[model samples]
Target: MTKNCIYSIPESFLALLTVFISSCLFAQQNNSDPKIQNQFWKNVQFGGGIGLGFGSGFTDISLAPSAIYNFNEYLALGAGVQYKYLKQRDFYASHLYGGSAIGLFNPIPEIQLSAELEQLRVNVNLEGSNTNSQDYWNTGLFIGAGYRSGSATIGGRYNVLTDKNNIYGSAFMPFIRVYF
Candidate 1:
């Protein structure tokens, strides 16, 4: 003969569960309310950068997409991802992918200052005499300032971590940033 088994619920657990459900039901701005959610999303801004260049045996194309949460009129925090493809005739073809975190400060309406940290994975294929493949990681920390007008900013940033063998080949990079 077999006996039936019974599991019992603790009184404390039952009371906590009742409170949780009640609080959820009485919440004024829960995620289930689309209006409140939309208000929260209104604080976010989306933006990115794109590059395309082709000339005498050289081709370069890049795209970066980013988003930011504006805490107020003067401060914002954001993140972005980038991909770049480059080819130099008979020399090498390379692909780079990276991501970055950025912080922005606007002391005045027309001036914006920024700091960004980036990390990238580089894959290169040498096409000529020493045909081979190379893979490595590169990182950069950039500090920049820009002139802002409406949704666009024209600026330049310097990478403090620049080294002779760095992928960008230069410490200073010019940029045009736009957001919508």
Candidate 2:
């Protein structure tokens, strides 16, 4: 009976090893099928930010819409549009509009690195007597890193150009992103 027990133990372990190996091989084969490859536009994601605020005599509104196309598990390219309006009491009002192109790289599943180039046009109007207005364009380059969990991402970026008049308003910008 001892001899029989020793043989059965090895037989059971060998069977389990065989099952594991075959399952792994099947998964590898399935992953390599062309039909299993991601289709273009199939994994596109769309989401961005909206900002709204109201104070004693101030108002701020912003809308930014973005879209991303996943080329594979590790790379994506995207674009976005931004618009903002701000008014303070009876002082001045400003409008900012822009567009951007972005690229993302993921070396690991949960970590992302991104780069973007944007061109923005700013219009400022004085609320007082003369009703004067001025417009200008600002270009920015930003690089960033983020951590992604499921469909949400939180990140920070630094503008390399860092123009004082850039609509983004700061050298460092924090962003929250959701993918749908």
TM-score for each of the candidates: 0.83, 0.74
lDDT of 1 by residue, 58-83 (tens): 99999999999888999999999999
- lDDT for model 2: 0.88
RMSD of 1: 4.1
Give the number of the best model, judged by TM-score: 1
Candidate 2 per-residue lDDT over residues 147-175, each given as its tens digit: 98877778999999985666665889988
Q: Which residue ranges in model 1 land beyond 4 Å of their true spot?
A: 1-34, 129-132
Query: lDDT values of the candidates?
Result: 0.91, 0.88
Worst 10 residues of 2 by lDDT: 33-42
- Which regions of candidate 2 are displaced past 4 Å? 1-38, 129-132
Clashes of each: 0, 0
